[model samples]
Target: MALASALAIGLLISAPGTSHGAGPRDVAGTRHAAGTHHLASEPGSPRTVSTGWSVPWGLSWLPDGSALLTERDAFKVYTLTRDGTKRQVGEVPNVVTTSGEGGLLSIAVSPSWNADHYVYVMHTAAEGNRIARMTFDGSALADYKVVVDGIRKNTYHNGGRIKFGPDGYLYATTGDARTPDLAQDRTSLNGKILRMTPEGKPAPGNPFHSLVYSYGHRNPQGITWDAQGRLWEGELGDQTYDELNLIEPGKNYGWPRCEGSCSTSGMTDPKRQWPVAEASPSAVAYADGAIYMAALRGERLWRIPVDGASAGTPKAYYAHTYGRLRTVESVPGTKSLWLTTTNADNSGEGEPGSDTVFQIDLT
Candidate 1:
């Protein structure tokens, strides 16, 4: 067993059914039936939508039901039709695919895409990680413009996940980039959740009076908003724990000082934490009153039931059946979800043409 798994065994035996005082709750505001244990049976099976991708990473749906997908090591973006036909949009300009984890990471369609034809992307460049905008003219991509730059980047821990929130502001997740101190530095954009405008300016009413909306994160990847407009994040821990955090403006999620939960002043505790072997969670999506988290190392999809500000014990699906799940995107106007796998990447099992996109119907 891993160190985290051993630690969790001792902790569970000592505490029995509690989790650092705050545990997931059910719809009736009652304690979860499964208590603090994160293990649960698979809910349902997911249907394959597309396959044969090389490290597919990001996924975003367009207004016309077509979806945009990104390949991390390939540094390429493609549009996928409902029938699974893919057309290469273009390669992001100047993307550097490192041997480690940094590369073309995420894509976010502009809120005004119909009029502006703008699509934003986050990728690793020669200097560092950056967010850029390009015009997608239905068939091709052009008019490349750098929006945000100077975010630190290392071989790993780039934390490259970006999305447009319901509030019409762009939210991006950044990692410590191997520099842990940068997480605590308000002046640095590393290890922060940034809220910005469509024009790349800091969103008004940002908690830090800068681009940072939340700080002190290790390597947060998945970010999504609840029905109540509250932001939640999925974070990877360093050999100790994996966290699901309820993000709040200006809140400091304890990083180097604390891995899971701490008594430190001004540090926010995670709503749920699991052993790293069970959850190296990636992109998350909220649908049907639950948060769906895609796991990479753990090789599963976690379903955490949500009720207002509380979350319920998480259930696992497709554990080890499919390898290295990357991102989970909720389909608009339906109870279905889109998930992508990263088996073709270096860290994964690297099955031949094994990278695939799947559709899961929640109803």
Candidate 2:
């Protein structure tokens, strides 16, 4: 429950903003469904689900409309109530937890969470960051299988996020693990967004034969799609600029060799860029002809409009106010965007359980 502060004050709320009104206003802000955004579900003013979880990450709308959340530091994925009661659904195996960044990271519901009941996850496994599919039978996971395993591992840049594209193929984002050279290496999975079949094989018709859809990324944590089916990603820069890249098949993003908009031969340029201090974006989702980014270091939520592959100026909201927003998700099939907080991370602000899941009222 954050009060509506002036845009400037919102940016500074990262410092435990003094309560101008009462304690945490229970306002849903304004309606975000209209204006060129896609609407997933038209229900109410916007709801905040789950109260106690710290460092909430991945998010997606269920077929039934109940959203799913991932907590990077909690070790388990809980089925959160729209009104904020978290119920543990399952635990991720081989989750190597530390500090700064780590743990049960991202989860993607199967194209058929209702029937197939499978939910895919990307986490730091024993070998490295891997993707797994688990079947949740309402209260718990009935089966867990490591569909893809043994990716390169580095501490700082694990790049653990997974999403299923509209083409029914799986797309994953990997980090450079602080190793600049790996980003340019086609053979390596780090610092790249991979496209694979549901069975984990390289997607047919992909630029490369081995699931390397796009490469040369630093640390892409967020992955989304546009109405035209163009794949988009949010890349975290080490010390320079965070990027919003239009992920194309087999294209290179020029990691260590280039940062923002570079015209290196055969290398791809980011559609948008922000200094690391202003937007350490983790996840991104599209709506209203725009892509909203969840900032971890900047402690803000950034929005950028996309026209085909190009992007416009950033529209920032909940600036220091939400502390640290880790993931912004456009609830599937709708215009509602779920904005979750990461204020509980080691480098974040607020108490351990101050994070909340918010839904944007589209209509």
Candidate 3:
């Protein structure tokens, strides 16, 4: 696929209730000619909600419009109100942040959170990468329990994104931990997408009859379902390409054998591929028939329109305007997306206290 044409437009930068850094500028909606399906060029600026975060990695929304956020290096969780008031919830115990990309990564509030009050987190521990459950009492997180463990961990490629599917099952993406061969080893938990119950058991009807749902991933950090309940993933590749894949049951996404796309039999090709420098894509979210992907190395937001299982050409937005976007999530019951920046980390161009969260309107 060819790169989408760039539109020179202006955006309105806004910061609500806080006077700090600038938000996205040059807000213009992409316009398409009649009956044409193309990437959108209208990219609007987001509103800065909060700042002063240290490599914030995960974001999950509570029932009452509050958000739970995790800081990767700090091993701390915070609750941010809609008005941008942030309060420290609690620190995750025994988290190992020594490794480069290892630390507190992703968070998911249970579908039955109102009743169970359970919040799930994926973090790096002394043994390896693990998923743990903690109880949230509207104030703090307690009763930390390790739900799943033994995922390989390394300085990089500890694929750390977790979310609940529309079917109410928990899904996790794991890296090969720099061991590329592990991506092909289905028996190993690394380099694959795992579907399991909230209790850490394999979800029934999984294609492999094991925890592995799909294998042959390098380091997939983003997973979200489209309106048709089909899963989409954003993957980080080696030096060649970054991929946006449509995930299927028991399928193999060619990793070591193929980076982006190949004619190899039985290996699923990516729906879209971009150069590594253009898209070290991280977390993704679906909203209004399009998948929004946050790019770290690219330092931009990508919006790809999805029709059924196929994706159209992707358009880049906010390119290099913000340093290192880490997560993008759709706000439930609204046409908004919550984006978090990962500038405080080693790979970013931000200062010590330079991470932030922004609210973007897609309407």
Q: Give me the candidate number with maximum lDDT.
A: 3
Alpha-carbon runs more than 4 Å astray in model 2: 1-47, 332-334
**Model 1 residue pairs with clashes:** none
Candidate 3 lDDT by residue in tens digits, 1-363: 221222111121124432222332211221221122443333455688888989989988898978899999999999998688999999999899855889999999999999999999999999999999999999999999998998999999999999999899999999999999999999999999999999999999999898999999999999988766799999999998888889999999999898888879989988878888878999988776678889999888877777766676577777777778898887766556788888889874777678888886653
In order of lDDT, best first, we have: 3, 1, 2
Evaluate all candidate structures by whole-model CA lDDT and list the values in order: 0.80, 0.71, 0.83
Off by over 4 Å in 3: 1-43
User: Local error of candidate 3 at 328, Å?
Assistant: 0.4
Off by over 4 Å in 1: 1-43
* lDDT digits (tens) for residues 223-287 of candidate 1: 98776678999999898888888998999998878788778998888887878887899998877
Q: What TM-score would each prediction reach against the true structure?
A: 0.88, 0.85, 0.90
Order of candidates by TM-score, top first? Answer: 3, 1, 2
Per-candidate clash tally = 0, 10, 6
